[model samples]
Target: MDITIEDKFHASCFTLKKEDILKFDKEDNGPINNVLIGIEHHCYGVRFFDDRHGLSVEMFYINGKGLLKGDIIQLQVRDPQYYQLLLRFCVLLADDYKEVNALIAFNTFQNKLRGFLEKRGIFTVTSLELRQFKGQSAVMVSPSPRGIVKIDFINQKEFYVDFFNKIANKPIEKGKEHVYLMVNNDTGLIKIGRSNNPVYRERTLHSKEPSVHRIAMWCCEQNIEKKLHIIFKDKRIRGEWFRLSLADLIEIEKFMDSV
Candidate 1:
């Protein structure tokens, strides 16, 4: 089988014999599978099959023009383990194309990729949703292992900083306190408070009420406790405590998005 991969940089042709395809199939204990390859062009297709029954063939089409401006290479693998293997294969084949390796790394291991990008002053925002609130555009960034974070800043760098701060669990700076929403594990009650020292505050709350746990915290400049108190006045069970409800939680999220 002959395979050709053409990109903006160069054109290369690769040939795989019937024995080689059989070897791979035998090792994986599966028939030749189809894998999707994507780059700048839309018509490219890649396929694999056995040749003994007049079916053995592996073909990939690559445009000779190479990568142009705004070109991104994408690969889709259905199997998780195969995804990793294909990524490694791509890295080897596209050894000179740094962007190809980067795209694979980002899609395969997003958390690790984000960490790497952040160290080098590059950031990616995923699951971003924009909403119109109070006649203003509100941007909501949903980072994994954390709740949605809303910020009013339009600057990309500042937005990345705010998003990173939340995901990293870094301490809130003085005068840049956070409005935390916690829940009592035993009683299922919600607690809202402001704190610059969240760790200490969480410890203190646990000491006072051993069954309480910090659920989520939002970084905000203003005193959010006051506004939250007024909004959930009816649901308030006691000082800084409210009866947790689905409606109240949705309202809380909306409030966060607005700020």
Candidate 2:
């Protein structure tokens, strides 16, 4: 199956297929180009090409680690406008598929693409966003409508405040601090921390530890990390590290909702 989005200026299309998905395990031929793994959704494979006209993206499902056996969709966007709408559509699709929890980017453009998604109420995790190619870091995102709405209202009051903050390297407001929970999907270990700039923090953490995989962050006004640490003191394996438990995860989600 295929879906296309076009306007007078450009055209974009997506193709879906039911085929053997690529595995990134050690046995496979070098990793698929620009692979993005989603905990809830399947995985994505992205490729970029440019010519005299402009830039284009070829996106597809690279693996089925978490999804049921069915048709996987591949997307192609020709330019910026098409790319933007296509990504919004992708988020809608992701919302429908619980398995998709992250979007993968291979190149600079895709990194920016994921950033755009992040601004639209979709949050990202550091562990799930991987950069196969040695270049700039990839932006890994998860959906958080509350966070998105908050950011949207902030941007409206002060246009591009988020974007400028990143570029200008401004300090994140102490009052706007967010407490984040990072989970290692492979080992099932969790880390609790706080940051005003979660994305930058994720990039730094990814650079320091390649093993970290899935992350969940929630914004709060209070110092919740210390409180959480005390609450899970018995389960603490080390500094800010704890054994995985459903109770803790549930509590964390509930805290996010309250704050």
Candidate 3:
């Protein structure tokens, strides 16, 4: 199956130029940038990134064909942090077929993803949006701090469930300030920032289109937060948001504790 179309994709990912990838489908939400792709043998591997390196998912395997007869599409997620996101996305492709060899259920997972990223006004969570929008449910997707996180939105629930599940340190007692890491559901960016009140900052950033939720917080001074910015300057995509991975995030938390 031909995974990529000539004009469909902007260009090869060697340049790491976001403009190289066509963004006709989505203008804001449900978009990706700086994609790196490769193929080894029959395996198609890709890395999706934001601005920061840590926030990216690399070596995502979209198997070319099935095991024996080129049937049963396979999606392999190597990154531990993004397993939930990949799993959820792959589930949809799986649902449409019991066993499809010709197109391997949908040409390939890459096609499904390219369509999701490039198509205009296509809701990956069709059923969820149908119920929410048609039902006139204005209830925005809110991420819970603890306990079982109710699935509100696709990306929203993934980060909360995966990132907040650990609940690293206890909540910031009842006192001082702290640097916070907020996750944006739509853009897939993590904001490493601070505020007099992290909760208030989160409220200011929260929204329906591009949802923002504070996933982690550290009890540290503003200076310490600045230190983090310097340390991860390479990952800094913009002001406070950094393309951070799970390990990078963990290291930030540990640094906060040490300081």
Query: What's the candidate order when arranged by decreasing TM-score?
Result: 3, 1, 2
Candidate no. 2 TM-score: 0.33
Q: What is the lDDT of residue 74 in candidate 2?
A: 33
Give the lowest summed-lDDT range of ten residues in model 3.
68-77
The CA lDDT of each predicted structure is 0.46, 0.47, 0.46
Clashing pairs in 1: 7-66, 8-66, 8-67, 50-55, 50-56, 51-56
Number of the top TM-score candidate: 3
Q: For candidate 1, lDDT tens digit of each residue in 4-99?
A: 233411322343344443444354322232211222331222343322222211222222234321122233222223334333444443343322
Arrange candidates by lDDT, descending. Answer: 2, 1, 3
RMSD list, candidates in order: 20.8, 14.5, 16.1
What's model 2's lDDT at 114? 53
Compute the lDDT of residue 175 as modeled in candidate 2.
48
The C-alpha TM-scores of every prediction are 0.35, 0.33, 0.43
* lDDT measured at residue 55 in model 3 versus the true structure, 0 to 100: 26
What is candidate 3's lDDT per residue for 25-102, written digit by digit as tens? 133222222111222223323344434222232322222233211112222222332334344333332332222111
Question: Model 2: which residue pairs collide?
Answer: 40-99, 40-100, 41-99, 41-100, 121-148, 123-142, 124-141, 124-142, 127-213
How far off is residue 34 in model 3, in Å? Answer: 14
